[model samples]
Target: MDILDQLGAVREGKLSRRKFTKGLLAAGVAMTTVPLPARRAMASEGEQATYFTWGGYDIPELFGPYQEQNGTLPNFAIFGGSEEALTKMRGGFVVDVSHPCNQSMPRWVQTGLFQPIDTARVANWGDVIPELVDLPGNGAEAGKVWMAPFDWGQTSITYRTDLVELEGEESWDILWDPRYAGRLGSLASGGDAWWCGAIKAGIDFANIDTPEAFDKIAAVMREQRPLMRLYTDDTTTLEQALSAGEMVASMTWNSSAVLLQAEGIPVKFARPKEGALTWVCGVMIHKDAPNLDRAYDVIDSLLSVETGHFMINDWGYGHSNSKAFDQFEEETLAGLGLSKNPVEILNAGHFQQPQTQEWETQMNELFEQIKAGF
Candidate 1:
């Protein structure tokens, strides 16, 4: 069945119950019927742009200041992965903006689901770090800026500090450590597993389209399967499991470790010797955005130094605007698990690359097999 059909069935309740249950293990959907007054208020005050992003990225605390300045919150929605978000938007859900990881940008652009930004309208465009703004290379030529970068960080091991010991730099080898078999928590779906496996195989992330890389990663996924406790996408649940000692350690985004530390959970996030997987998540505009001007306002507000501080400390990710770091004190910046020396830190990082469709299909099959306890 088509991915869109799968999503439509999810909305209509016509798919297999098991698949639906598995989908629940994927992304959370927050939607509602808006009254006419609310809709009118959005048009008059600010465009009610719905952001489809990770759970922490859409926090009330994070957006409160933006709301104070603009008078209305960007109506928000959350999701577990970029693939799931794209599936919903293409399945007929309309939202003015979305947050997609860098790896998904090529696919999202090719599908023409998003429109490039009118850079003139975004006031804070000058503050975005050049490297992040040019993520896809010469983005201006692509007709519209496909992304307005927000947060970036590595995918590393988040382990129970009291349980695991490392003799050297953190490596992908830790997830396969047999000592913690049956008590590990791994993300069940989405593109994370593929990225993790690639680092373990030492494949070049940006050029991983060959059959050789695929075979090596498939073997790695199979080897790690039995050690997993639950195939989950919820970071909150994953953190709870880690805190309770249900999972000794597992592959997770940097934000998970930040949240754990904030809650006083004994967890440590590491950047391994083989290089940690790096991914960037940013806001996107719909091709036919109903309120383009207001959408730009929300983007500018999010990129502001004040919002960047909250995002770094609370959302547990590095901001795309270089100056966002200026908003933090020396110690507060360190708390986000980012090194002051960016070049040194990025040397231990590798990006998640956009896969060709064939590769994605094979990857999904391998992921399903692993989750089934193969």
Candidate 2:
């Protein structure tokens, strides 16, 4: 069965381990062998702490207030990839918090790099959505929140609706359509590209371990690459391409679509048939994080409803705080694709976990091969 059908079964209470195992295995999940991180604490606040996160995530607008409250500002560093974050952490970067996705949580935990969170210290902890706060691997009691969800969004097909009208809606298969040869855009990075490729290959992305599955993904991407105008990591470029009619559609973050729509770009962010490749960025405290208390203050600040509003309205990503939705007008909610009932969206969304180093290595190697025209 296809991914959508499998999701349907899951939603209907019919998806079972027997049916989902191969897909899970392909996704490289070894249930029995799941690794957890070791516990350790870095020096206290007298020493400085560095934070490694996405570029925008640590902006002064976001962290300044926390600094004012905590009396110490965290030194910041930026990374484009989770692999880069992991690499630095392993190499003794004393980050107070490292923004990693849920998928990367397991790998970081297994590496003994994280200092578990003290939920009690975070006053707004109760405000976080229950499922989101207490997901399968969060390990709240162990003082390691693994990662705290800061923002969430779907990976969808961003297309100029004025340019093309499909019968039903945009689907992942469109990326593979020969009809649109030489007119597509794709990500040059590993995570987004692999997730996008897996969906188009018709192998459940959650199950991608087999050589056949990897080959299936590679074959489709090879075909799509010829059609792609260029593989890029910058969303700014994707937006420019769409606006100039250089490319009509591309896979991109929901925020990009929201921004374009606000500018009257006539873009449609379609939730593909295979389900959107959903991702959430979280704050993972480094095991040796200095200024531990201050780091907690930063986490609390980010979790505040006020911050959530800024994240949702200004940043264009869904906040981890459920309360943030209450602030949005009904029409506004619909425009951001948050109008769908929460449960429905969550059930349909494909959450990514941090991949193991082995998988990361394979992905990097495979991605390189694809880029080199192999």
Candidate 3:
């Protein structure tokens, strides 16, 4: 079935593998990242600075403060993956702010498509985790960072506990397994997949730029290509497939597992023995943001404590705001694969390291070819 039909089944509670008392929309369904209706009355698209982000993040829950202050939610533009969003921006698509993970932060900055975010404007700036904001190419000047760290989480294996049998301690090798070959799914973006490929190849993130590391990663990715059943960035599509038992496991973010678990799916967001791919994604204002003041408000809203709780509990990501953890009990946080102390999770995983523009070009190019069975 097509993506829409799959999600339609999910929303209508028609997926037959198991019964989901709560539909996929419970976590606010992930859409195509196109122009989405705001939860509240939406102002004209031209009136407010647009928020360019991933599909699920465009929902109204995260925009509570932004809508309260502006009388309406800002224009929402979504992209299936970060690479596509960056490509569009590089091709003269100017947006008020865009979401990008730390893996692409340096390259996005090098494109000259963004400006440093003045931390003074973000009211919750001081509450953001220090390690998250301290990224490479984070602007030389203090208080002005290239990206305001918003949601951070791990990119790892989310597998079916009932459908698949484990061989030993969980590892990235699950995605490369020959037994689950045709039943595997994955995200199509290089940002997460390529880095995870490096991990699976036993390459160090700190030394991933070397020629040897690149070749080893490429060899492993090529080996796994033939085994994948679907490689799309759409969350609902993959999640529905998992719900229906069409695929056994997928390379997914923390949010996917949280949403799936809520749907009553017997899934585990595996903490692979090799290590999970940890990342921090946030907003960067366009150099010429149309509504510059409102753009700051958009960033501020995303960084707010209220949004932090939603991101952590509902979306299953580690929010930048430390205070957001106060509302949740330690036991609850552990269940979501998060902690009150952000560093505990961030440091335990393979935190991403930024690369130069050239490395990005090479990785993207090579990955595209590999995905195409080249």
Residue range 1-374, candidate 2, lDDT tens digits: 76556555544434432234334334434323432121122224345456777644544445545756755445667787788778877887777777887667777788888878877788778878766766657775656477787777777788877776576766887666666666778767777888777877777655776788788988887777777786776665576577666787888887667666655678888878778887766788877777787778778777878888876775467777777778989788766776424545556767665556798789878887888788
Sort the candidates on TM-score, descending order. Answer: 3, 1, 2
Model 3 C-alpha lDDT per residue in residues 1-374, reported as the tens digit of each score? 64455545544323321122133334443333422222432467679979999876666568779878887667878897777898898888888999998888888888888888888888888888888877777764675889998998999999999988999999888899899989999999888899999999999889999999999999999999989999988776788778778899999999889878887889999999999999888999999789988998898888888989888877799998888999999999999999988789989989998888778889989999999999
**lDDT of residue 127 for candidate 3:** 87
- Best-fitting candidate, measured by lDDT? 3
Name model 1 segments beyond 4 Å from true. 1-47, 142-144, 329-335, 339-344
lDDT of 1 by residue, 68-148 (tens): 766655666677767778788889877778888777887888777788787777777887876677665328564557788
Better of 1 and 3 by TM-score: 3
Question: Cα RMSD (Å) per model?
Answer: 9.1, 14.8, 5.1
Model 3 misses residue 47 by how many Å?
0.4
Instruction: Please say which candidate is ahead in lDDT: 2 or 3.
Output: 3
CA shift of 99, model 3, Å: 0.9
lDDT of the candidates, in the order given: 0.69, 0.69, 0.83
How much lDDT does candidate 2 score?
0.69
lDDT of 1: 0.69
